[model samples]
Target: MTECDINNQTISRPGNSWLAAAVWNNSYTYKVSAHCPLHYCLPYSTHLNFSIPNSQCQFKRAGILCGHCQQGLSTIFGSSNCQKCLNIYLFLIVPIAISGIILVLLLFILNLTVTDGTINAFILYVNIISINTPVFFPQLGKFTPAYTFISLVNLDLCIQTCVYNRDDYAKMWLQLAFPFNLIFIATSLIITSRYSTTIQRLTARRALPVLATLFLLSYTKILLIVSSVLFFYSKIFHLPGDHTELVWSVDANVPLFGVKFITLLIACFIIFLILVPFNIILLFTRWLSRFTLINKFKPLIDAYQGPYKDKMYYWVGLQLVLRVVLFAVSSLDRNNNVIIGIVLFILVIGLHGTTLRPFKNEIKNYQEKIFIMNILILFALALYNHGTTNMTAVNVMIGLAMGHFILIVIYHIFTYALSGVTRNKLQLHINTLVGWIIRLLNKNPVHQSRLDSHVMNKIPTAVNYHEYREPLVVQD
Candidate 1:
C-alpha cells in the first residue's frame, strides 16, 4: 500500500511499503454534485488501510464497531426514512359526526311547518315575491311565471340584474369558474416544470429517485389535465336550453332519454374530475414527503430550488382564473339542476386548491375564504330562490337546494378521505426507495470480498450494490 500525509506529502522509505495520509476535514465536505471519482471508486476500508493485520482486533478494542458505531448505520443516516401510515380514522369519523349534526338541523326545519301564522304569512309573502321576480331572463316575460323552472330562472336573473331583464348570474359565475379551474392547472404545470428542471440539474448518483418522482408527478398531471378537459366537454353535451319538448323516448315512463343520458354523463364527469385531482395531489404530496425525508440525510438534494417550490403565487393565479371562468360559464342557464351543478363545480375547484402543494401552509386561511364565499353565494341563492311564481314553485326550489347540499357534502368527504389514504401509500413507496439508496452507497465491495474469501477460498463469488441499484459507476 502507498500512503500520503494530510498535505499530500508522500513518504517512501527504502524497502518499506509507501505510506500516504490525507485528512478530509469538515471543510472538505462531500460535494454531491461534483465528480469525485477517487472516493467512489475505492472502497472505504481499502483506501483507509483498515485491512492491515490485526486492524480488526484494534477496531474491537477501540469500541469503533460497537453500539455507538452501529448508530452510523441507522435509517436516519440513509438517504430517507420510512413513512408512517397516515391515520385514516380521523377523516372517516369527523364527516360522519358533522353529517349527524346537519341531519338533526334538517329534521328540526322540516317539522316546524306552519299553516297561516303571521310569520308564516310573511315567509309566504317573501317566498311569493322570490318566486315571481324573474321577468329578468330575456326568454321569460317581464314578470315571474307559474312554471317552476321558469320561475327559478327568473329569480336567478333578478339576483343577477336586480330585476328580470338580463342574466345577472352569468358574469359572476364566469369569473368564479376560470380562477378556480386555473388553481389546479397552474400548480400542476409548475410542479412538472420544477421537477423536470431538478432532474436536469442533479448528478447521476442522485438523479434516479428524483427522476422517478418527477415522472410520477408529470404522469399524474397529464392524467388530471386530460380528465378535466374531458369532463368540461361532457358538460357541454348537456345543453343549457330546456329540451323537454325534444324528448324522443316512446315510453311515457322514460320520456326524456336525453335527460337521463346527460345526467349519467354529468355524474361520470363529476366522478372522474373529482378522483383525478385527488389522485394527483395525493401522489405529489407523497413525493414531497419523500423529498423532505431525503433532505434530512442529504441536504444537497435542493428541495427549495424550484420556482414553484413555495407555490403561494400558483394558488393565487388559480383563484384568479377560477373567478373568471366561473363568472362566464355560470350564465348559460339558471335551472335548479344547472345551478347546483355550477355550485358543485366551484366546490370541487376549492377542494383542489386545498390539495395544492402549498395549501397545507394556508389551509386554515383558505378554509375561511371558502366558507365566506359559500355563505355569501348561498345567501344570494336563497334570495333568488325565494322569488318563485307560486308557493308550490318555492317549495320545489327548497327541495332542489336541499338535494344539492347533500350531494356536494357527500362528494367532498369521499374525495378528501381517499386523498389521505393515497398519500400514505405514496409515502411508503418513497421511503422504500430511499432505504435502497442508502444501502447502495455504504456497502463496501472490498469488505464483502474479504469475507467471501474466508467463507469460500476457492469459489468465485460476485455481490455488488451498484449492479442492483444502477448502471454501474460511470467514470467521467
Candidate 2:
C-alpha cells in the first residue's frame, strides 16, 4: 500500500477519534486533520488522559498508560518525556530479574543430594548476607536488594518513611517489591511444607527454612501494617505537624489510592484478625500440653505440637512484629523521641531474649543477646549525638557498630575453633589461668590467714599424724 493510503487507513482505524480528541485537547495549538494518521506520533502512551473520565483512561485503571493515550501524549509532550515514563518499569524489572535468578538457584540447590545441615547452613549464610546488606549500604534501602537474595525481606519501612522521606519513585519501588515478596514467601512456604516430614525426622537439621519463614512472615506483617498506617491511617487521622509522605500519594485529591493500598489495608486487617485467634489457640494448646492431667488429649496436643523450631519461629516472629509496630508508632514522634523509643524497645527485647532464651541453640541465644547489646549501645551513642554540630559522636557510633560486627565475627571464629577436644583443653587452660590469677590477687594478710586456715583444716590433726608415723616406723 502507498504511504498516503496507509496513513489514511490508520486514521480511519477505531479509537483514532479519542486519540485525536486527546491530542487536540492536550495541544490547543495543534489542529488534527482528517487525513493525518495517529501512528505519526508514537505507538502508545501510558500517561493519564484528562479529556475523558478517569474510569475511561487506561492509566487510571492500571498504573500504566494505554496505547492511545501514549500516542496522544507523545504527540503533545514529545517522545523523550514519554520514554521517561517507561523507564519506571526498569526499576520493577531489575529486582524481579535478580529475584528470579536467586529463586532458581535456591530451587536447584534444594534439589541437590546434599545434607540438610549443609543446605540449612547455606541458607543461613544467604539470609545473613541479605539482612545485613541494607545495613551496610543504606543507599540500596530504596531499591530493596535484600528481597532478591533472601526472599521478601525488607528493612524497617517506618524508618524508611520517617527518616528518609522517600519520594514517589521509592514508593513505586516498594509497591513493586511487595508482590515479589509475596511470591517469594509463598514459594518458600510451599517448598518447606513439602519437606516438613523430612524436616521433622532430621530434627534441628533444618532450621534455616523455619527461621526464614518466620522472618519473612513477621516482616511481611510489618510491611502491611506500616503501609496501612502510612497510606490509610495517617491520611484519615492526621497528626499535628505530621508531614510524613503517604505510600501512594501526598495530595488529598490525586485519586492515587489504587487497588494496592486498599488491598494492603484489607490484608493487614485480615491477617491481624486471623493471627489473634490462631496464636491464642496455639498458646492455650501449648499450656494444656504442659499439664499431666491432659495426657488423655495427647493425640490432639501432638497434632498441634508442630516442631520446637516452629514454636521458636513464632516467638521470634511475634517479637519482630511487635518491635516493628512500636517503631512505626514511635516514628510519629518528633526530634530524638523515635531514637529513644527504639533504644527502649531494643532494651526490652534484649531483656526478654536474655531471660527467655527463645532460640533452640544456646549459641544463637547468646549471639542475639550480643547483637542486641551492640545495637543498643550504637543507638545510645546516636541519640546522644543527635543534633550535635560535631561529627565525633556519629563517627564513634559508626566505629563502634563496625567494631561490634568484627567482634561478632571473631567470636564465631573462636567458637568454631574451640569445639570438641580443643574446647575442653581451652577450658582447662582457662580454669588454670583463672585460679593462678586469683592466687596472685589474694596477697592481703587477712586473705592469706584465711587461706592458710582452710589448708590446715584440709590436713590431718598432729596427733593423728604422729600415731600414723609411729605405725610406719614399727613396720620398718
Scored by lDDT, the top model is 2
lDDT of 1 by residue, 252-299 (tens): 112234565355435446646654444433334435545655346232
* Predicted structure 1: lDDT: 0.32
**Which lDDT values do the candidates have, in the order given?**
0.32, 0.39
| TM-scores of the models, in the order given | 0.18, 0.41
Candidate 1 off by > 4 Å: 1-280, 283-367, 370-376, 379-476
List runs of model 2 lying over 4 Å from the truth. 1-85, 88-95, 100-226, 229-253, 256-264, 271-285, 288-318, 336-355, 387-476
Collision pairs in model 2? 44-70, 45-70, 46-65
lDDT of 2 by residue, 1-476 (tens): 11123432232222211222233435532112111122222223323233332322332121112222333222111011122133333454465556645643443323211121112222232233232322222233233232232334332231211112222333434554544564565456445756787644433223334333433334433444444334432122222334333223221222346664456446556656654544444455555556686566443333323223444433433444444444444334325443554556576566657566555555655555554554455445545545332234433443554454446446545654676566889999999999998988697788889989999999876666565554534543
The whole-model C-alpha lDDT of candidate 2 against the native structure comes to: 0.39
